[model samples]
Target: MGRNTRKRRTPLAAKALAASAALALGGGGLLWANFHASAHESHHDVAWGGNRTKASTAQVVTISCPDVGQKLTDVPARARTEVAGELAGLDRQITDAYRRLATTRDAQARDAGFVQNSILQPLQDRRAAVLDRIGLEVTRVGGTVPTGLSALATCTGSAADRTTGGGQDGGGQQQGGGQASTGGQQGGTGQQGGTGGQAGNGPAAADFVDITKVQPNVPAKPRRTRSASTGTFTTRCGVNTNKNHNTDNVIVAPGVANGAHHLHDYVGNQKINAFAGNDTFLQGGTSCQNRNDLSSYYWPVVRVQDGSQDFDQDADGGGKEGNVGRILTPVQAQIKYVGSPTGKVVAMPQFLRIITGDAKTTTNGLANANAHWSCTGFENKVQLTAQYPICPRGSKVVRTFAFQSCWDGRNTDSANHRTHVAFADAGGNCQNGFKAIPQLTMRLVYDTTPPTLRNGQVKNAYAVDGFPEQLHKPATDHDDFISITTGGLANRIAKCINRGQQCS
Candidate 1:
């Protein structure tokens, strides 16, 4: 976005099926049975037979399963790889089941039990099998497995209201009429055209709010103390001009292809993928203006629903997984590091990984949801989390991610990839046993047309790519960062902050 403004017109080749083929080739092996058991358990029965009418009356929009990754707070070093792979398998199972649900709408209309019996039940069985393997792997390595793993295997069908696309009023309260407006203005009532967005899976008419009508919700800034660092450092990283795009997640599911099940736009480090190791990052080239900053930054790509398909239209994490349309690159990508407001900050450990928001927020609830959506002009006045802002002409859309600023000081990574880092408190103080570190904040500005709502339908909608079952909801938007700054560079940043001087 800084220099390369032209969009890449040529579509890349579709991803090969070698990864899936490899999995299939091992189906007859013992590892396959351990990872995927054919035996089905009926302990957790779904209430579908008698709830047929209810299911038919209210459409099931997506599948919701407990996120096993979030539950695994600790794992022995030897078992981490195997457990992570099984967790990825759990996600794959859910994606496969969602595809089944989307294509069987006709069957669901005819039989109320179709979704439950054919989709959810089988999904539960597959998850249970994977969960058991995860438990066994941890226990086999002398690590105590987290309890209640079996209880998390069961999944249920989630309706639209319970999901991110659910209707909400101006104050962020759930409303039955699908209205989200402020100052007596009514939002879109375009229900005649059916649910909007791609594959009828997201960004409903209720998901948009006129930014002009939103009230000023920005809180007052915290008062800085005498010991405050007060300085900042900025890094110039182009807005993915080289088009480093992928569906793999090196942080969450290392060595597994297509683990994310959604496309990501990457900036900074050039040699990142699901199979990349720490050594790869240390030796890799970068896109940042400062070669010393070899860190990696990435998030899900935002796509415009303009009736076109990208190269991955038929591939696993693209259109085939319900993420369709033309991808939009941001116009400006600002990466900055700010000092602590309470005291001098410490240098972060090299290779430290931090994931700010929850990608499964729609189903996992709002405990860790931190998405902030607004327009460039209204940044100081309003920030919408669950709904996309319909900006006035001349104002561009913006997405901001304020990463965790406190570190546990013991590990660069955690089993869940979160416990090692945390956000500062309202008073800008780190919690007990945690130390303050320079906060990394990314601000991305997009030059795109604001979507419009007419007759209760959304037109020209843009949404963040997400998990197949996540429906590309705004709340599921998240960011990932890997701190690969050289030790000398990190020390210089800390010194600049402590001296109250801005540096690059």
Candidate 2:
């Protein structure tokens, strides 16, 4: 059987409190795209991005010990001592591995420096190897060791102690029995204090894999585009609409009302009025419901490829121009007729909603792979707040924030509620739907002692025993029916047997 090499992330409830703290920090700038916040490009939520899937603990245990017994069963008695010594050495290595992992976790919390290659992964791998060797030796010796024997064993008896001894699996610890794997599930919340936290003059520890850098396919900075629609507007100035898209006919004037010489009724706060010929036009309120609307534009700093300037593709053009870009309001104005006939003018925001993405692609893009919803069901405008990563440790994990909307993909809402935004790839893939989307994952370094038998179990012989005294016990090395170790010896042996069968 081929070895499983993938690492995954498990969501813990601890993440929520951390997020809340960040939010209270008044734009900690770690969650989304805001003027005052840090860019959280590394805290990506999609799987394959920072959200890499984690493997079950049991599977990792099996992987750590791939060859459980063959190495020592046939050795001479003189070499048996050598084997025992080697097994003891393995036990110590496993212990050290776990201790180092705990230390690493503490180091990450303090923002101390450490690399995945030099200090973290090697220790984990070594722990796995040592546990494997011990598991094999224990299996060869026979069934689970008696309570008395356990006292003499080389590894920690407690599961957590065994795990920290080697730090082998990605997800927390493996469960005792059969259960579904949780490798690719979205992370719930993480613990408070962020990163690994502070460690006193205690044991050394290691940090988990920064999920941000896990996938090569996911981009560090995604491409975005922004476009605006021409809309009608009404202000204290006179109402005017040049059929031509040119701005030549628009005029700005004081909102203050003059004397009866230029009589006019002020609409709302508007004091200026438009006149047709010599007569003053009786103007009413203006609503630009179906009229042209004013627009705004914003371009972002793009993450370059190979240090070269390229096309800025990620700009989602949906906001108003300049000052109006952040917040949009409905426009109202008055329109004067050419005939001087008494009439009212109403102006409303021509564009009540924003449609994002490249016009060419929005009409047609690759199978909805990169389009994320800034808004919800109502198409309400989304106010992007902050975006940045949790940690920049080698992996490129990123998280983002915005005032959640009603799932309308809009910005206008009568009733205030919690905001919910959907995340997806830059290509337009959404987190919604069936297929598991790549997000973030942590490369956890943990140790666990392999399983050992409980005390007081009845022992049995290897040879057949159904018959009477005529049935003879087989004189062989395969006499034991169980084993005792800090790793998964039976699983490894089974794997090796299966592989041998395949080759045969």
Candidate 3:
């Protein structure tokens, strides 16, 4: 495969202006029984359709809106760049609106209808304009615009009452299990304080659960048959000791800086950013011990909210955006490629990009959520999806990501960045004209102290970086990958897996 040097012209000034205006605003658990509702489904009645008289007391915590990018499944190839830029603009609008809300709490307290009139409505208007541009771009490229694209323009405010509780629909309590306490106040003296995590947006007390209380939920592994490919190929990408960190997302918002709205800890490929083209990736250096594997692996940085500030404290994606704390470096980052259980696996196409989890799961729902949080010693016994696990003493935090293993065998990417790859079904068989490809799994371990609850306040709480409105919830945790493996190395990996041998 050859590197694609085709570059799309993006409006850098327009994106930068949107970001500047946003700079001003700034911004678990699977306890299946304790699962919270998606942002759209969890809005408090008083904040949504109820009388405005009650708005005086209702505290707007975050913003929730339909994810326009996810709905654009049929975008034409020529229009993708323009449409993506418009999608990113939507995010900037939300960020700016959230910042306005955060800084005007006094106004909200005085005027019952302040939030609805001053913040959300303006955001909706801004988003509507962007959505119109997106539609025009699609039509210009001879692609049919997705129906109801205009309906997603309206944004809503999520009140604190609905967002703080353990279960969104359960009204601050867990059913069947013990009461899900809305844990303590923010512990750190950092910029975060007031209602939620140190940053004041999320990781509420209700967002954590004791591992001892969670039942063993790990399902039994699928049985491998005689024809199953049982081998594994491990790639030794060292922990990001080099600290190759940034706040850019090339796949989603290429040419837009701070596109992720949160810091990312990167490993594997040394050259990664919003501006990196395919040629840059092909010529980039690698952190992997095997130079042939120049694949990139990255995820949002996890931070201890203990009154600390990273380099981005006042930067757009940092404290200004409500992401504040000391970033924790993972002690171990294990990257492995394993075979399919149903049949032999094929090599992944070069430059194939895969995002393994949903960064907006809090708002978009759990249909695509794949976050796996557990303690080092108790991973097999308990895995959490919505709440952060309170690991026992001496245990470390673990995050696991299993990438999609089925490919469409055509496009290397998709309009939504997801339709090109799909997860295998319950029987481990690829469906819908997709072919089985080597499965990529990552295990990241971190050495961190468990947060303590004292006097109804949490101390040393840790959280993953996220969009300001997403509130740093564990459920929003996600990972990104791009396969830049040389043909020789990819072939070797396939050979190792087909022969049932383990190789590096």
Candidate 4:
């Protein structure tokens, strides 16, 4: 990652660097489905920011020509070769960063708090910034080069249409190249998934809608950051302020720590998965280092509690409603989703909305994380109080109903395992567009010894279902669970159903 702010591009290597720069800056790919150009308008009057003289639209066409027929036969071949070389160097740098992120999670684990907070995080930001900068530069040169190769120009229609960046297979070339260009009145917004072409004159069409700004993006982030303060303390559980249990915060009780220990079998490996730092969050905090405190990762094992009273005899006809009973813990659960019936598990879309909005260096040792939980995990099972307005109008939102699944070492075969505990909805119900679902799925599959029953007689159950176990028809199973704000509310429920009973 060398900073190339040096304005001096060796004259010979400028063109190729410019072209590659366009891809990096202009977002060369069609992923930005939001921005589109007008249809069939080829006026060639695009305002090239740096240069004033209008370049012929034909030059753009030649620039897009397949490698075999590239335009600019006139720009000395030497300059093109040099530009190509420099671009190769930049590509290598980008690839290196991705490799570090994808494979170095463990290495990052060894980093001290300051290194993780100050150095590592900034490196990630720099990578993203460089990507955007290069993309913008490439677009600038792309805009200019095509105009110079007018003879090879395959572009047609009004200027707006040309900007759309979509067209026929002229010169037998592939279509993806330029950055997204807008063709319409300056700043009017367009709805999601809609398409319209604005012409050079007449009424301008709506502006492009950015998908990144509107879709549900699930991030695997934790509620709290790790603390070097308590490198190796052994507390049973920890407690603090009751700031209304926010969806983003985590609260642990003393008994729950014992439950997690009992279920997982192994007491102290450090629940790194839950305590790791999350890039998605603006603020990171310290963890309770006192091992005796009782609020470590394993301390909060998901348990099956009773919640039968949550159901109504009329609406549910004596059947279980959304909130029936259990604390869904993340001991060994894996929640996923998908569209096609290809049998591949589809990843449920998730969004973490930070509640406090105020950035803090830490959660101050004891406080519920604040944030909104929206996803398909609880689809069909739980209900929503208000409709989620941000998503594209028709996107189907489904969720896996919440369940308390624990990760006991029953399946010693795997590093961890999970089981499901049923819960009922307190008051909400499902609506037309949205569905209720579970936020976690615990798994366990011990005994990897070579089995003689490969003949299909003995089914290979993951086997993590030890202390917490229950079964139901696919539709009636306890599907989802929600977070409570205060320890008092949770304690009240725990007392009402002392030994685990249906509240009714």
- Candidate 4 at 362: error in angstroms? 33
> lDDT (CA) for every model shown?
0.69, 0.19, 0.69, 0.20
Per model, how many backbone clashes are there?
5, 138, 13, 100
Determine which window of 10 residues in candidate 4 has minimal summed lDDT.
Answer: 357-366
The sequence of per-residue lDDT tens digits that candidate 2 reaches over residues 332-394 is 222211100111111111111111111011111111111111111111211110111122223
Candidate 1 or 2, higher lDDT?
1
Off by over 4 Å in 3: 1-59, 163-195
- Predictions ranked by lDDT, top down? 1, 3, 4, 2
Give me the runs in candidate 1 sitting further than 4 Å from their true place. 1-61, 105-112, 158-195
Kindly list the per-residue Cα lDDT of model 4 for residues 1-504, writing each as its tens digit: 011111222312322332221111010111001111234324333221112222222111101111101222222222332233222222223223323332443333445353235433443454345434433443545522334322311211121223322220011110011111111121122111111111111001111112213323222222221210111111222221111111111111111111111122112112222122223111222122322211112211111212212122122101111112222223222221111111111111112111110011010100111112122333222221111111133322221222221112122111000111111112222223332222232121111211111111111111111111011001111111112112242233223233223221
Model 1 has an lDDT value of 0.69
| Whole-structure CA lDDT of model 4 | 0.20
Minimum summed lDDT over a 10-residue window in model 1 is located at 25-34
Higher lDDT: candidate 1 or 4? 1
The C-alpha RMSD of each candidate to the native structure, in angstroms, is 12.5, 33.7, 12.4, 27.4
Candidate 2 segments whose C-alpha is farther than 4 A from its true place: 1-70, 108-116, 119-504
lDDT of 1 by residue, 400-460 (tens): 8888899999888888777788777667888899999999989999988888766555777
Angstrom error of the Cα, residue 96, model 2: value is 1.1
